[model samples]
Target chain A: MATAKDRAQAKAGSGLNDDIGEQKRLELYRTQVVLREAEQRAYDLFLQNLVKGTSHLSLGQEAVAAGFAGAMKPGDLSFCTYRGHAHTLARGVPVEKVLGELMQRDNGLMRGKGGSMHLTSVDHGVMGSYAIIGAHLPIACGAAWRAQYKGDKDVSVCFFGDGTTNIGAFHEALNFAAVWKLPVIFVCENNLYMEYTPIGDVTAVPQPAADRASAYGLERILIDGNDADVVYRAAQIAFDKARAGEGPSLIECLTYRQSGHSRADPAKYRPEGELDRWKLRDPIKIYRERLLQFGVAERVIADIDAQVRKVVDDATEACKAAPPPPLDIIATDVYADGGWAWRN
Target chain B: MAELTYRDAVIRGIAQEMSRDPDVVFLGEDVAKAGGVFKATVGLYEQFGPLRVRDTPISEQAILGAAMGAAMTGLKPIAEIMFSDFFAVCFDYIANEFPKSRYMSNGQVKCPLVVRTGNGAGSRFGAQHSQSVENWCMMIPGLKVVAPSNPRDVIGLLAASVRDPDPVIFLEHKSLYPTKGEVPDGEIVDTLGTAKVLRSGKDATICALALMVPRALEAAEKLKAKHGIDCEVVDVRSLVPLDTQTILGSVARTHRLFTVEENPRLCGWGAEIVSIVADEAFYDLDGPPVRITTPHIPLPAADILEDIVLPTPDRIAETVRRSLQS
Candidate 1:
């Protein structure tokens, strides 16, 4: 019996074989594996009491993050929500630095100030990840506005969850972005849940992206978030439109989070058999099988898996050995000029 | 120096910074074709064109959020929220996003943002639009709050605010927009968090901000001529980094301290000033500090009732005389 993956490949990858060749498939497969392993390692460290605070893992939502972040230009900006580990890693931040930041070490990306929820790298065009849901939407529009103001061809991509569409900032950001025709793409990774409650329970509209974005006069598209190629194609179309000065587009990727919302959440509210069902369609498993069918040698897949394991292991070891940030420097980064301090 | 209205001074200050730095951009409702409700941003849209001087939607959340976003991404954005009271709608961005972004990112990003708004209560805009909520922002640690009284100071403070490497809430009183004064045409950049002594006297120290600065000077004149009490008036232009040295110096010389503002008396900027004096300059003060502020009530639309509700020169003079008696 042909599975859903086979049917999706037949329809999405038919004779239009120009989608992506064997080499690109292997690259995407490697990136997806690296992100999966790194996230798992980070979780293991958290369980060991090395990573401070809570961690929001994108366990099963790797396809959307990889597709969107990989499609961006080097100068283009990408903003993420608290479930941002996969997004930041996909933006080319080194595994060691990400682990270091998660551990709050001196050599972290933000010098130990920002933990897992606030990871950012300006050099990689990865704007800071916001802890507040939907708050980063307008900020992403601002970056796009800056790009438009300077007549630059760069586009900004904002990655948020299904829960964000219900907030006022989401509406305001879409309205302003459409009015100005700013170069931005808003990607809604609909993982079916807003923390604990199902998205359908909290959201007013059934199709959040199409329903909300159409009102703002923005071009909206819904795609299968579990399929990397589908997300990549949708993102390319949106990015091309934005670069052509056609304003912003909304791409809603329908995916699911395999893990709980945060480290502390057990997600016992998940209905029976839901986890087992999603585990069968795990993005890594499906993509790995697809890469094999695409004629990539088994040795290449094995080599990639080994390489990812070594990278995650070494990065975790380094982060654990790193020291915490100095106490004297605690009050230094509050302001740019060093005037403001935490007064007693 | 050239004669320019307070509104034009704001325009000139912004225009000058816009011309000097390519990264400076302006965006707000009615800022482009409408030239701002108070005309403070007049002629800017025409001078810099649409890309630089943008007319945004009436979403204070997006306006302020975009300012912080653009500021972090190598742009100095000056966003105008039409009225100070409207800040309540977007206080989350001001209180959380803009001020904490730099700190949260561990100094990797700089938010050189200036949110210019028309403040104060003389226009009969009523309670919804007439509240002086600058004190609400003063409690936040990462933001700089400044309110300028005259055209000259507006020019200097606006320029400095644009150049500062942080977020500044620039307050311009609605009534002072059309008032004309001599302003310098050349660069007139003033330091942030500094106070200027408008009048020098030896008997009592009068500290005020925004529109109250002029009323404080008037009260000082009446106190000296009619009551034989010499009062020194200090315009605390900047509120966040309170200039304790200048304020303490004036208190040491005059031995008496009095604060005047148009906001409600409870938990206003005056309260912060009085507490600071009592904490740091207690020994230098000869008498207990006095604060003359509006009573704890919403501003009314009627001019007669509003006049009685807000502070006035007579009330300031009477407060000074009463304080001198102690």
Candidate 2:
């Protein structure tokens, strides 16, 4: 990994505007590795019956979360869909708390209240992970609106699947964000499939989110989500534009999900060899090779890989030992008073 | 004290909050510059300026979703849904997003916001535009529902709802917008989950909300003058954090209960009140608790049909008179 001094030197030497210094590239690579390992551990926990309810894994789509989260500054908000394990982990939330949430334990991110689909840590600026499709897009716009209203330099980044672009809230939020010039970035992780069906089957346009960008008077942005470098450059540009008060940008990243939509899905509907074909372009695999090609020491790559494995392992053990939340918590937090009583 | 219209009270209430807290923002379609479609929000845009008082495109979901997002952060936003009927379009935010955010996040996120909508029927806006949907909001847990009958209550309760940490659905009656009432000077902030006894009587308890409050008072007056039966009129203001104590006390004193509701008959707000009264104050009741409500049918544009369907003062007086006699 490049040190701060090395990164500064590299930035000084490289006159190219789009060059993300060695430090940033290494940071993105490390984020992808951590997300990938943590997500794989979550899958393993599900297989062991430790994880309760359903879980949505972003196994093959680490680059999108890593790139966007890396580009975002502190106080910037992130709103994502249910397939949000990667996004949550990428925001610097501990692997233990996230895993504990999946296990429905007292040590969970939300103390087992939110469970798998609704992971939220306001302290981390991960606003929420919404279960409903296209719901958080408008919410992200609102957060951006708040930032704009307060004259804060922070931006809001929203993530969703390709299916979300087809939802009514998507168009509503886009037009609202554009007209208001809200500092928000709408990132569509077009992972080929929308739940069980291929996005192309139901979507009217080829690039679901980007093609519809023109309708809202936004720039048409589409990129390869498998490459962390490409995604990082795009995210930085969008973030800069939003912070400069140029309004929201809609970026559709073409990617693929290696796992089924959720724990219950077998993903048998995927065509033969589709998974195999996507495996060649796997985000983590590509990022690791890219790091080596960029002259990052082999020892540095091995060290990060080993460190992430240990983190995931420790989180798994801790989550396995963590007890379920107390029954008394069931009625709490319904209102701001911390009680569920609707009537006297 | 000075007299003010219900519409003017809305502007005053919002202005009071906005002036007090820089974080409080107001948004809706035509709410800014255009002064809202109903003209209930006149002078707010001019007072607060464009950023604080915003007007959005006709997008209900975005309006509500944005409000929830803003609230989840550090802002106390007051979003107008224009008509209460449009809640159907953005029901996801009301039912799923706003109410569930704090609970689902285990108290990490607090949505201290107000969604004020023009509710109830009297303007002959037809089925789509006209609806007394406070009952729709009352059913959802984690929400504070408020429907003020007069200008004073509107300002007081709107102030209260804006200050409340929980999400509040403030229902401003469209019919009562132009009606005038006395409002005390200064920042009038009231409490949620409290009902006021508008007119006290010994014979019977007349429970009402929003549009029904005025009609219930009129019926009470006629019942006292004609039948010599004094009825206590109770304004059931906040529905979610229902002031059951006030209602039960009124029922206990009167020993009879009657609810006048403008919502459809099946699952109206009156039904819940009646059920509670029947269960808790069963022995106190001298007769079966009666509910005078709009028939389970879509409101029509015609004035005659609409007036006949909605619970009127005459119908309320006749129903109370006949029920007491039997």
Candidate 3:
């Protein structure tokens, strides 16, 4: 029986047949495998009490992060939501740094200051991971505005959940970015649920982000976020459009979260069979099958899986051995001068 | 020195910074073609051109968010919030995003931006438009707050704010825009967290900010003539990096402390000063510290009601006279 991947690959003239060769396909598969293994390790660490505080996981939403981050150039900026472990790892941020941050260690990306929700690595072009739902949309616009003002060819990509579409900042940012012709791409990963509730229950329109694209004078783009190839192709076109000075594009990627929203959520609110049904179409599973049909050897796929497991295992050991940030770190970095003194 | 209005000083301050640094950019609602609602930024658009001196929509969140984004990257942005009262509309950016970014990111990100807003009540814009909300910004830990009373301080302090590496909330009194004062010729710059003692006296220390500074100075003159109580008046230019040294020194010499404030009585900037004085300079007090402030009520639109609500020179002098005599 011909699968969806077979049909997609057989379409000779489609965008799927473009420059995303066997090497890039294998790379996309590797990214998803790494994200999956790393996130699974994080979940286990949380259970072992190694990861402190609250964390939002992107267990099933790896394809969107992997696809978008893979499509981006070196200088392109990425702004994502609190559910950003996958995005950070996909951006080439060391797994140990991410895991160390989650473990609240001295070796963390922010030296244990930002924690999981606010991961930032300017060196990797991951601008920030905003816990506030829709705040970074306008911030991403500002970064894009800077690029436009400086005549730089860098595009700013912002990722948020379906829930962010309801916030006032989301609308304001969309309008502002469109009016200024900013080099930005607003990617909404519609995981069906905005926290515990389904997005359709609260949203005014069926497709929250895509339906409102016309309001901001943008082209409506909706894609299957579960497929890495689809997301990667869409991301490339959007980046090209933004870099060409054609203004912003709002892309809604339809995907799902395999786990609960956070470690605290059991997701009791979900309908029966929902999680089980989505599990069959898992992003990693689909990509692995696609790689086989493309004539990539079975041992090659196994080697990638083994490599990802080793990376995750090494990161976990390093995070466990790392020490907590020192007490002096508490009062530091409040201002640009590296002091918290508000008064003489 | 040339005589300049507090409004023109705003123009000069911004022009000076924008001209000196190509990275400095300005944006707000109607700030470009309309020259700001208060007319404080009259010639910036014409001088800097559209790209650098752009205008924005009525989205306060977008305005400040974009400013933060730009500031974090490379450019130095001066965003106008129109009125200080609208800080309520975009308090998340001020209270959460800008102040917490550096601390949360552990200094990986820097927000080098200034949010200049028209503040205080005198134009009869009523409760919504006219408000002395400097205290709203003062409580936030990472923000630097500045409110200048005279034209000279306006030019100098604004230049300092633009150059500062952190986020600054620049409060310009709407009522003082038309008021004139002598401004020194050539490039003028000043420091943050410094208080200027306008008059030195031996009997009482009067500390004020923004619109209240001129009122406090006037009250000092009236007190000396009517009651023979000489008052030292200090202009508290910056609130976050507060000049407690100057204020405490003045209190130490005079042995009496008074604060003339335009904000409402509840949790005003004056209250903080009083608390600081009580904690550090209790031995210097000859009498209880007195705060002359507007009663804790929403400012009314009527001329008579508004006039009676805000602190006047007569009321300030009388308050000092009665407090000292008793």
Query: On residues A156-220, what C-alpha lDDT tens digit does candidate 2 reach at each position?
Result: 99999989989999999999999999999999998988889988899887778878999999987
| Model 3 Cα lDDT, one tens digit per residue, B104-195 | 88888899999999999988889998889988889998999999999999999999999999999999999999999999999999999999
Predicted candidate 1 versus true structure: per-residue lDDT over A84-180, tens digit per residue: 8898999889999988998999888887877889999988888989988788999999999888887888999999999999988999999988988
Q: Rate the local accuracy (lDDT) of all candidates.
A: 0.86, 0.91, 0.91
TM-score for the A-chain in each candidate structure = 0.93, 0.94, 0.95
Ranking by TM-score: 3, 2, 1
| Per-residue accuracy of model 2 over B59-169 as CA lDDT, tens digit each | 999999999889888899999999999999999999999999899899998888899999989999999889989889989988999999999999999999999999999
i-RMS, every candidate? 2.5, 0.7, 0.7
RMSD of each: 2.8, 4.4, 2.6
Per-residue lDDT, model 2, residue A201, is 94
Off by over 4 Å in 2: A1-18
Candidate 3: pairs in clash = none
Each prediction's TM-score against the native? 0.96, 0.96, 0.97
lDDT accuracy of residue A250 in candidate 2:
92
Residue B66 accuracy (lDDT) in model 3? 97
| Interface RMSD after interface superposition, model 2 | 0.7
TM-score attained by chain A of model 1: 0.93
